[model samples]
Structure formats: C-alpha cells, structure tokens
Target chain A: MDEHAHPSVMTFVAVWITLLFFTGLTVFAATLELGPFNAIVALGIATIKALLVVLFFMELHYSTALTKVIAIAAIFFFMLLAGLTLSDYLTRGWSTYPSTH
Target chain B: MPDSETVSNNLKHHFANLEQQTATSKFGMWLFLATEVMFFGGMFVSYLVYRLSYYNAWVAGSQTMEITLGATNTAVLICSSLTMVMAVHFAKLGKRKLTAIFLIATLVLGMTFLGIKGVEYYKHWVHHEVPGPNFHFEHEGNFDPRHVSIFFTLYFAMTGMHALHMVIGVGLLSWLLILNALERFSAEYNSPVEIVGLYWHFVDVIWIYLFPLLYLISHRHTG
Candidate 1:
C-alpha cells in the first residue's frame, strides 16, 4: 500500500471510539464546577475530537503534501479571524474606561 | 495502471490519469470546505462576542437546551461519519455493493440526526423559545429576555445553517445513491463517492463543535 492510501479499518474504529469517549468526557466535565477552566477543558476536548476526524476520517493524514498545506491553511486563517477580532473587543475598554478596568 | 481502462470510460480528457483526476477533485472539495469553515466561522465569532457581553443570558439560554437529545445526536452523527468513511473505503476497493450499503447506512444515520433536531425545535416552539412574535423566556436572576433572545437568535442561526448543510448533504447523497444504482462508480472512477464522503465528514465535524457549545454550556445540577 502507498503511504498516501486510506487508513486501515482498525485505525478508523479506534478513532471513532476515541471520538465517542471524548464526547462523553466533555459532557461529564461540564457538570462539575471548574469555573473558567470548564470552558477551556470543554473546548480542549472538542479540539481533540475534531483533530481526530480531520486527520483520519477526512484522510488528510494520507493525503498529498499539497492537500495537507491547504487543509492547514484553513485553520490558520480561522485563527486569524478569531484572534484579531477578540483583540479588538478585549482592548476596546482599556483606553476609555480605566475606572472599569 | 490496469485501472486505466475504467478511467478512460469515465475520465474527462482534461486529466492525465485517474490518480490526477482524483487528486484534483479532492483538492477542490477541500477548498470548498475551507470556505465553509469561514462561512460558519462568522457566526461563531458573533456568538462569542455576544456571549462575552451577556454571559448570564447565555447560561440561562444554554441551560434550557436538551442535553440528552443533543448528546444522542452527537453520537449518531459520529456513527454516520464512520459509515461514510467505510463507504469511501469500499468504493475505493471496487466493492460497489458494499459501498452502496454503507452509503445508505450513512444516509439513514444523517436523517436520524435531522429528525432528532426537529424534535428539539418543536420543543423550543412549544416553550415560546422561537425568538419571534411568540418568543417568551422568563428567568429568576434578572435575566433580560432581549439578551436571551440574542442567545437563541445565534443558536438558531448557527444550528439552522448547519441543518441546511445536512439537508443539502442528504440531497447530495441521494444523487450519489442514484448514480450508484446506475453503475456510474468504479474503483478508479469513484470520485463522486469519495468527494461526497468528504462533505459528509465535514458536516459531522461541524456538529462536533456545535454539540458542546450549544448543549453543554452549563449543566451544573446545583445551578
């Protein structure tokens, strides 16, 4: 088999089970009071699950190098979108409302 | 390539061989999925900004979500993704019958997800949570209905856009199913099945994020 071939059945099943486990864990983590860490943990678990799907189920792991670059670019630009916007919102109050700050 | 015979019957003259054709098709699909990421990304950014401003309303609105149904749908969608990938594998192996079977299984699972979502929407409608003329949400901790409406508004927008994609997905699958029955697919010419599988998995990934953000926002029993 070529290095760029689809994953084995065992790999697919393992990834699926891992995804399900993370879903349950995220749900359970939400029940406890972890304060802000709760959101961080939930999103963290979700990012893990999403990475598994992208890498295996979507076959980006087995895809060509060019395909991999395009796929990674999507995430890079998405971060740019979120990071730049949040920077503005997080700093908007710093200049005008020092009393609240 | 022995598979070259199958390719010639179906391949367009534009491509050099089946391998090139498949790679090009997949590249295009990934490009489309990337744009989709940004499409859904806009709603997510707005939701985050509003959520930061009205954390209380997000909690109140989120608490009303049906976690049981949402969680079950998440599991169901993951199951569908597995089936979708299996379909692609079997298609690549030239096992047309098995490929069709798995495709059908994926379609069934996808519909089941949409059906559960419908039940959740019906419940929202019954509770006056639809965010329109009949919209009404009351809370004890001085939560404003306006801000709460904002939560449901984004909720519906994001999930509604997602559901629309699912609807389009099932339609795409149905077309593939028809083409399969017509014997339009082969190991070297199965780009349609493979490409649609990518689309199906992408939709599943969207729900992966949606499940927690929408349903499990604050499931604290004490609160």
Candidate 2:
C-alpha cells in the first residue's frame, strides 16, 4: 500500500474498452459454427475478461506479493476442484444413470 | 488518554502505520474474497458437471436465454465495475464528492442490471421455465424436458445467487454513500471504499463468466 502505482484514469478506461471488445467478440464467436471450439472460445474470452478485471479493476497488479499469492492460490484451488471432479466424471466407463431416462 | 491523539489521525493503536493498516485491511478483504471464490466455484463446478451430463439440454436451455438481455446486463455490470473502481480512485485521491458520485453511478448501474434480470425472470415464468411443478421447456425430440428443467434450475440458481450478490453490493454502496456524505473517508483512510470496490468488481467478474456459460452456449444460426 505504500507508494504503489496508482493506475491513471486512462488505464481504467482502456481496460473498460478492452473488456467491452472481448464481450462483443464472445457474442460474435457464439454465432459461428465452431462446434466444441465455440465453448472453448467463449470461456477463453471470458477468462481474459476476468483477468483484466482482477488485475486492473481490482488492483491486484499493484498489490503486495502476499496478496497476489492469495489471489493466485484461489484460482489454483478452484481449478483443482473442477479438474478432479471432471476427471472422475469424464473418465467413468460405467454409466450409473441413463442420459435420456 | 495518550491514544486519543493517534486515534484522531485515524490510525488504530494496534497498527504501526497507516500503510500497515491499509495493507492488513486489504489482505483481510482479499482473504474473504478468496473464500467467496470457492463459494461460487462450487456452483460453477456443479454447472459444468450437469452441462456435460445433459449437453443438449444445456445448449437448448441456453439458447432460450434472451441473449439480448444477458449481454445488456453484462455491459451494465462492466460499466458498474468501472464506476466502482473510479469510486475507489476518487476516495484514494480524497475527492469526496467525486467518490460519492461514482458510488452512486455504480449503484444505479447495478440496479439496472438487476432490473433487466427481473424482466428476464418474468419472461421465464410466463414461458413456464421455472423449475417446479409447472416447469415446461419447449424442446425438440432430441433433448429431455427433465434435463432442461435441471438447466433452468442451474440457470436460476447461478444467476439468482449473482443477483443476490448485486443486491448486497447495492446495499454496501448505499452505506458507503452515507459514510462519504459524512466525510468519513480521505486520502489516508479510504480502505472501506477500496475494499468494497474489490467486492463489487468480484461480483462483476462472476457475471462475466455467467454470461457465456449460461447464455452463450450456442447461438449459431439454424436454417
């Protein structure tokens, strides 16, 4: 908090523009016939938007190292949670439940 | 009391300096937000699981989502995040009036988002999309209505929880507005504003993911 780089007004506005552009890009991407890639693209653009907000709008870029670690740890654990659950589900051969029942 | 003089400077007796105080407060807020990340992460994981299980219903359910409304709300929330950061900026710069103004703007934009969400909810209710005894999803032969009900259930659960966060954020902003009006924050002591900005921006971040996962699943043109 001491002598941290306070982002100028222009930076905030620039990030806003970038976020809006990405939002439009996601909507545009959804209209394309990309199959599974569409979901990837949507989530990819969303991750970019979330990163921008977290780093800039939330000022994590200017935060202390400890704070940055905490933030990153949160994402890491969330990934672990989702990854483990999905792995279990995706790798299962026996379908305990019917899809159309 | 000797502490009275220090208290007048807005520095708590336990903290060594204002810098330590600010950093500690921000650290605590970040910790709280970390837990919030986990809270919402569970919901997101559940969403992914169900989406994988019922891919068609998820996509079809998502298609029924009013992209126009969802996208509009995304933009509104983004604007609100901008205003929230601006509020933090003004608070740090000790510009009380600008801080209050930006906080109000954030509040207004947040409410606008919720209003759009309300309209979308009303539309769902009329269309019988609510997940209850009357829940009816108009789907083709490929997808199951029961799974579509699950989609709507997750949709409402995710976005409803999000809207609830927005409601709490609006209430926090109102409180900050009152404090701002009282001239409680200045350049040296604006932790409340900054911390609340973090919360508001986190809420915005949640919606950023929600928009795509729940609304933009599949919007390709069908002949």
Q: Best by lDDT, which number?
A: 2
User: What is candidate 2's TM-score for chain B alone?
Assistant: 0.94
lDDT string, candidate 1, B1-223, tens digits:
2455567777888988778888899999999999999999999888887777777788889999988889899999999999999998988888878988999999999999999999999999999999989999886665677889999999999899999999999999899888777777777688989889899989888888888888877895743
TM-scores for candidates 1 onward, in order: 0.94, 0.94
Tell me which residue pairs clash in candidate 2: none
Q: State the displacement of the C-alpha of residue B181, model 1, in Å, after optimal TM-score superposition.
A: 1.4
Question: A33-75, model 1: which lDDT tens digit per residue?
Answer: 9988888888899889998999999988888888888888989
TM-score of chain B of each: 0.95, 0.94
Model 1 off-target regions past 4 Å?
A: A1-4, A95-101, B1-6, B220-223
Instruction: Quantify how close model 2 is to the true structure by its C-alpha RMSD in Å.
Output: 2.9
Backbone clash pairs for candidate 1 read none
Question: What is the overall TM-score of model 2 with all chains considered together?
Answer: 0.94
| Model 2 chain B worst lDDT run, 10 consecutive residues | B1-10
How many clashing residue pairs are found in candidate 2?
0
What lDDT would candidate 1 get against the real structure?
0.87
The per-prediction tally of clashing pairs is: 0, 0
